[model samples]
Target: MEEYPISFPMEKARTIFRCSVITYLRNYHRFAITAATFVGIPFTFAILITQAILPISDLLPIVYNRLRTLFFAAGFPPTSEFFFDLSLKLSQTITSLVLLLPFTFSFHLLAKTYVVRSFRNKNGSYMSTFISLFFTQIWNSFLVLSANSLSFFLVSFTFSCMEGFGFKSPNVIIFVSASGGVLYSILLAHAYIISNLALVCSGIEGSVGGGYIAILRACVLIRGRTATALALALPISMAMTAIEALFHYRVMRAYRNSNNITVIMAVEGILIAYLYSTIFVLDTVVNCLFYRSCKGLNLAKIDGLENCSGDDSAEEDMKNLI
Candidate 1:
């Protein structure tokens, strides 16, 4: 029920980022080992094997056609080849998420719990923290899925409404689509920021109410700090995107081109995956620091208010005696 200061400046966000980097570097060995074992290995093997067994190329066409039909039926203009490519990428991402859900709930969650504990310099039962994180992750995942679904529905509804309103020109449809895309991106980004903070809050709180309480706290904490949260998340997201591209180019492309996986290739893939995992750990560190900053600001505000009230009361007492 505590209130947090909503006016989080970009400068504060930068400081949090710097502190997170320093923290990661200071404990590099511990974090590296934990990330490599729990996150890197499992993520690498899961991605490599899944893509090997069920290549995205095979899934691309089906996803592309389905998207095409949906859009066209909604009275939207035919999209460019870029649309096809985008659909394929989205399909691959969804497939990856689905395949990695188990690891996400287990190994990835465990890594985050450890990172949070270490960052806070706290000692406790790993099993207890892990269990709390497990349930929190479940709720966070559900919220994320719901957000995605809502965004998709809204976009489709926009198209349908435009069509019903007789805005059938190709230019008009394209413009509307662009506007909708921007709106969708904004909403989705906010949802992700909230979800990230909720996970960190849940990890830190370890309360009996689990994710639900943490999520509400995140909402309150992030009230006016949306820009700061987005800024903090952007770098990590870009790094992860670059790593994914590297994986696709170096590992998946090689496998597809030669139709054979070499030992050297496997090692390179693992290395790239490890790099991704490190970024993931850094992301958790950043979130933890952001949470602390928000909480610190809230505490400062409360103290300031209490001091003002006490001063006013003392002034009134003095006036009465006079």
Candidate 2:
């Protein structure tokens, strides 16, 4: 039920960010290699699966046509039709990716938690971390995706309306794209805030659901300080965008001629995926920094933080909670 305050002022944010970058760099390097090892191999496997599916999907039609010819030669017309239908189904298997997105996001979150633990030597148990990752990723990804999709639809509709009103179509498209950028940036910042809140909640109360109040508070905070919140998200966004651009460029360019593109893409994808996960994890660290900073600012107003029995303090509260 706590309402988070407006975001820190831009100048103060910059100073905090400078300190954060140094803290991140100093902490991040120690885990950099290990995080890559743990996350990269599985990510490579995922990319290979992706690549295999694409070729398999493309070859399905040809394979189906050949099988149909053979079936016709064997004089079973209905069986040949079934083969054709099977081809369509097989070709569309890539669509299963939509379902996989949640898991993909989950794995990224899990890896990030381990990376943080590595930095702090916090003894984050793997199973507990994995559970937190699963819930955080599924919930955060679903909410952000829904928000972004709605924003995209609304912005696109507004652009269409502008065009209908005789505004230049290109101009309208540009404006909509810019607005979409802002919307996504803000929602992404909100997600970062909420996801970190989830982590803190889980750490404190042993349940991701305990984070709901904090996550709701983040929504209110973001709304009241949209520009500052968005600005805080800028670095994380830039890193992700850069990695995505590289991933697309390398994969597409390699696909133009090289048979080894699959291997290359698999390697590159894993690296980029880890890079993305690192940024998300770092965003969480930044959120913690922000939270502590805000708490410091409100010290005069708030006599003390409520005794929430966080993990570090739980052993002391055992007699009471029991």
Candidate 3:
């Protein structure tokens, strides 16, 4: 039997994360070059072009008004500053997603596939994996969208019920809104995590039910390890968020203020994009390690059960002979 070294222990999220960093650094040359070429440059250009061509600032007010209308109709207070900020952030995110959809479906997917294949030491064709990942991403997008919809529906329903029961005070509404927002965040976070793991499963498993099946497997594998998964994901999420903020400040804000894109600004933007791509590569590596850890743990449990069963059978046989 080939012994599977439990390099990534499920119990120690920090250890797994550290190992992932080590692995990425060990293969830094290959991962960095490939990711920079296929992922970073293209994404940088895509973002710059999109921002230049379609300024999100122009669309922010439109989205804000739409959100305001929806909230007013939902009976939410008109003076909620939190809702206003949330609406703006949501609008910016939506605009960015729409603009970057092309690169996301193409170069980003290819980058993830390459990392997965490299980790597995597989030199096979990428066609199958790419196809599988394409579908998997679509399903993940749907799942995330559905989760968001459900969260909104639940919150709206709560407000409606409160109104129906005559609890229309501003304090009561604010309290309900806060509780509903917390619940919404929790649900969306889990959904996002599961969707990310599903992408990993599709890349590794290679089309064996990589769509809905991969999602189901991710949900199962993450059963007892949810906290570890969250912990492992936190740093990467924060790094990516910080990088985004940096890009906005250094690139977008500069462009907005000057109405000109200099060579220096472009270079800085590209560097930021490269850093973001590297983080994506690291995130993929971490997810792959996490998957292996979950599998190793599951296999260990099965082996333990088998050993116990064998011991019980031997004892029963001895008793029968006696």
Candidate 4:
């Protein structure tokens, strides 16, 4: 509650990354190959398929022309038309999202379980971790989708009401839409951030709500030290964004200039898949970094916890509600 500036500095980030990499490296050979291969394969495939198909539902035609032209120039082989044809159908998106749901969710759960087991200095099977993570992810996904849907519906209704009032200027529309989008995005991000923190906290103390509180306390503790957290977060975000941009640019550039259409098509597909995997890896690192930050901090003495009133009556209340 005190007005202190919390910061997630670069130095802290670097320290966290360094320590985590060392830990990951020490255990990498033992689990890295299997983790990357077995876990990575389905995860990457699901992400790629979903990404390719999702936008097609309502956004494809707007960009289809560009895609067609880009592929033609990229030298996609004679049968490349089949790929484009596939993209036109709604089935691709539905299929991709469906296929990806299990893999992505499972992978997330597995990753968290491993991290948890590692922190406790205990061995946990990948399958067990995966199943736990899967259920948690499903809940999280549902929470997110429902929240986003509600927010969008409200925004749309608001816009309709505004327009009905004869306030239909382009400027008004843009402002309203942008404001609505930003608000929704912020709310979504907050939910994700809280859930993520909760995941880590739960991993450490075996309670999701405890994890959320821990994160809140850490954020409060870092109020004045926020520059440190920001330093850590900004560069990582920038680097990830740059990698994504480069991936798209290269693929587009290749499509623009290539002549051996078939060869180019294969390369594009591979690259697209690779890009998806890369994003996943990057996200994994980011989460690892966050966990590392908490790991290094001397937060056991967090003052906020003292005020939380973990009283027996509170537990009783929770049980009654349940």
Work out candidate 1's RMSD over C-alphas: 9.1
lDDT for each candidate structure: 0.68, 0.50, 0.72, 0.48
Query: What is the lDDT for 215 in model 3?
Result: 94
Count of steric clashes across candidates, in order: 0, 0, 0, 24
Q: lDDT score of model 3? A: 0.72
Best by lDDT: 3
Task: Put the candidates in TM-score order, highest first.
Answer: 3, 1, 4, 2
**Model 1: worst 10 consecutive residues (lDDT sum):** 299-308
RMSD versus native structure for model 2: 13.1
When 1 and 3 are scored with TM-score, the better candidate is: 3
Candidate 2 TM-score, true structure as reference: 0.54
Cα-based TM-score, every candidate: 0.79, 0.54, 0.82, 0.56
Residue range 70-147, candidate 1, lDDT tens digits: 656755556644344445656666666777777778777877888766543344577877787787778887777777
All-Cα superposition RMSD per candidate:
9.1, 13.1, 9.1, 13.0
Per residue, candidate 3 scores C-alpha lDDT tens digits across 109-148 of 8888887776443445788888888899988888978887
lDDT of 2 by residue, 202-253 (tens): 4422344323544554554444444554566677768766765676576655
